[model samples]
Target: MEIRNPIPPFSLETALEKVQLAEDAWNSQDPIRVSLAYTIDTEWRNRSEFINGRENVVKFLSSKWQRELNYKLKKELWAFTGNRIAVRFEYEFHDIQGQWFRAYGNENWEFDDNGLMRRRFACINDLAIKEQERHIV
Candidate 1:
């Protein structure tokens, strides 16, 4: 696995960098690449589903992109303390049938010493919108 840089105990700049790195990684929609940012035994609660370990994380992300076609995401750093960070994000995607939707969410992340995420909890809700309502493509 490629070791991620900017290991935690983050300064304002590093925290912002972390958030942007996460946004960039997710935007790539590469499940394995994204999963490597987390610990091998990482734990996650994404909405109602509970995911444990890096392998499951890959599976979850793969399923997500399958349903959320052409996904585009933006993430903002909400706060950071110690090795933990909170983020607010919005993502635009269409279903396989091409019904547009925007999802707004918050994620709380805890990272290990190596900067690999150890835990992540997210709460998200989606709103249906017309194509014209979409601000991000």
Candidate 2:
């Protein structure tokens, strides 16, 4: 059996669209919707650990929300190619104890012809401090 590409076309516009969709999904705080953006067998290297599959994606996201309070994220498209995109983003959230922190990260995403993410590698660094320490909103 042959698989068909679900995406309309590969262009800079489509790349931007995918980024916007991801941003909206994250903003909604819906783990399932976010997971759907990736392939069923997606591979991920988030910070240190390696995770695969949609089920693991959902679980990881759920755990993330459980630990990160008042989570809000913003992602920007940095660059793109035929089936790859680079994104830079920052997120601010508080811990279980209400100790606020900001995390900055960059991600390289590879998509299949159907535009579903096949691989994602992200590197993030977090700085935890008091709320008063924040300068950027």
Candidate 3:
């Protein structure tokens, strides 16, 4: 049982802590590092793609970071109760050609008793933006 700490049945403070931790991990852009926060059999729905298991999480993140260069992410806790949390987030990134984009979205996460996220569903939209228009720098 690998516990990630701040185990569920979250309070406002712990939920906020969890959100911040996720934001920091994502900003690092290290797929393997980020995948550790989820369960071995975690499931996800990001945008239109459906992914299952930690292996796929790593693969998905690797592909994402490769195309989304210099990515920076910010996540805010929206609501929480028991083993679930909801968040609204925004992230900024650029492509290989230096075209910048900002993505805005919401995510619902369900955690296992051990504190690893067992499920995640995200709704995100990306908009083309000039570098100067970036909110996350």
Candidate with top TM-score is: 3
Put down candidate 1 lDDT per residue, 17-91, tens digits, no spaces: 999999999999999989999999999999999999999999999999999999999999999998999999999
Model 3 TM-score is: 0.98
Q: For model 2, how does the per-residue alpha-carbon lDDT over 6-57 read when each residue is reduced to its tens digit?
A: 3534577877787888887887778898898888899999999899998999
Q: What 10-residue stretch in candidate 3 is worst by lDDT?
A: 1-10
Q: Is candidate 1 or candidate 2 better by lDDT?
A: 1
TM-score, ranked from best to worst: 3, 1, 2
Highest lDDT: which candidate? 3
lDDT, residue 39, candidate 3: 98
Off by over 4 Å in 2: 1-9, 132-137
Clash totals in order: 0, 0, 0
Greater lDDT among 1 and 3 belongs to 3
Clashes of 3: 0
Q: lDDT of candidate 1?
A: 0.93
Tens digits of per-residue lDDT, candidate 3, 44-82, equal 999999999999999999999999999999999999999
Candidate 2 matches the true fold with a TM-score of 0.88
